[model samples]
Target: MAPMYDHPGEHAADDPIRLLAVRDTPLSLDEVHRAVGDAAAGGTALFVGTVRNHDGGADVAGLGYSAHPSAEAELRRVAEKVVANRPVRALAAVHRVGELGVGDVAVIVAVSCPHRAEAFDACRMLIDDLKHSVPIWKHQRFSDGTDEWVGAC
Candidate 1:
C-alpha cells in the first residue's frame, strides 16, 4: 500500500528524512533529485553547483575541496533546519570532495513541496545556508601559478 503524506502544515514524524551527504567521490544530480522525489509533492526544485574555470578574474586551472570530519554532521543539521522552517515535503543535498577540474559538479541540492514557490524557496535556502555555514574549503589553483583557499565557513 502507498503511504500517506501530510496535507500541508502538519509536522508528521513519518515524513521522509532529508538526504545529506559529503563524500570524496563523484556527485550526481540524478541521485539527489531521486532522493527528493515524492508522490505527494507537486513541485521539485534542484540546484547544481559546478566548478567553474575562473575565479576572481583569474582563469582557474583546477580545484580541490576538503572537509572537516564534522562536515557531514553539520550538513545534516543544516538540512534539519530547512525541513523545520520550510513547507518541504522532501529534501536532499550532496557535496563532492577531492580533485576536480573545470565543469565538475561540486554540489547538488533538491527540495520538494506541495507548491512551486515553496519548493524554490526551500531549495535556495538549503543551498545558501549550506554554503555559508558548512566547514568545507575550496582550494583554487589558478592558471597563473597561484592558489587560494576559500569558504571554510
Candidate 2:
C-alpha cells in the first residue's frame, strides 16, 4: 500500500467539513452536492432522507421537526467524527425542521473521498450518526388522528 499522505491533496487538505446546518427551511440536494465537490476526490456519495407517506403500518398525514438548541452543535460533532476517522476530502450535511408534508426532504448528506468505498462508508456514517445523536425530534401525524415522536429527545 502507498503512504497515507501521498494521496492528492492529503498534505494540504483543507478542513474536510465543507458545510453543516440545521435549517427550518427546505434542503437542496444540489446544494449539498456542490458543497462536497473536490478535485482530488475520486468518488462522492450522497444520502437523502424524505418524509414518506407511511410508517410502522400507519398512514402518515404529515410531520413536523423540532430541534433543541444544541442540535447544530451536535451535528457538527457528528460531522467532525466522520472526518476524523475517514479519508474524507469534503463533507456536507443539512437537516430540515418545522412543518413538512409527505414526500418532503428531511435531510441531505454528502461525502467525497479518494475512492468509492471510502466515500460510501463515510457518507453512511455521517447520516446514521446524525440521526441517532442529534437533538432533532420528529412529530409524525397519522391519518388516524394520532401522532408519534421520533428521534433524539
Give candidate 2's error at residue 131 in angstroms: 0.7
lDDT of 1 by residue, 54-144 (tens): 9779999999999888888778788889989998888887888889999999998889999999999998999999998888999999999
Q: Give the 10-residue window scoring lowest on summed lDDT in candidate 1.
A: 1-10
Residue 77, model 1: Cα distance from true site in angstroms:
0.7
- Each prediction's Cα RMSD? 6.4, 7.5
Error of 2 at 25 (Å): 0.9
lDDT of 2 by residue, 36-94 (tens): 88999999999999999999999999999998888888887898899999999998888
Clashing pairs in 1: none
Candidate 1 residue 71 C-alpha distance from true site, Å: 0.5
lDDT of each: 0.81, 0.85
Deviation from truth (RMSD, Å), model 2: 7.5
Q: What's the CA error at residue 80 for candidate 1, in Å?
A: 0.5
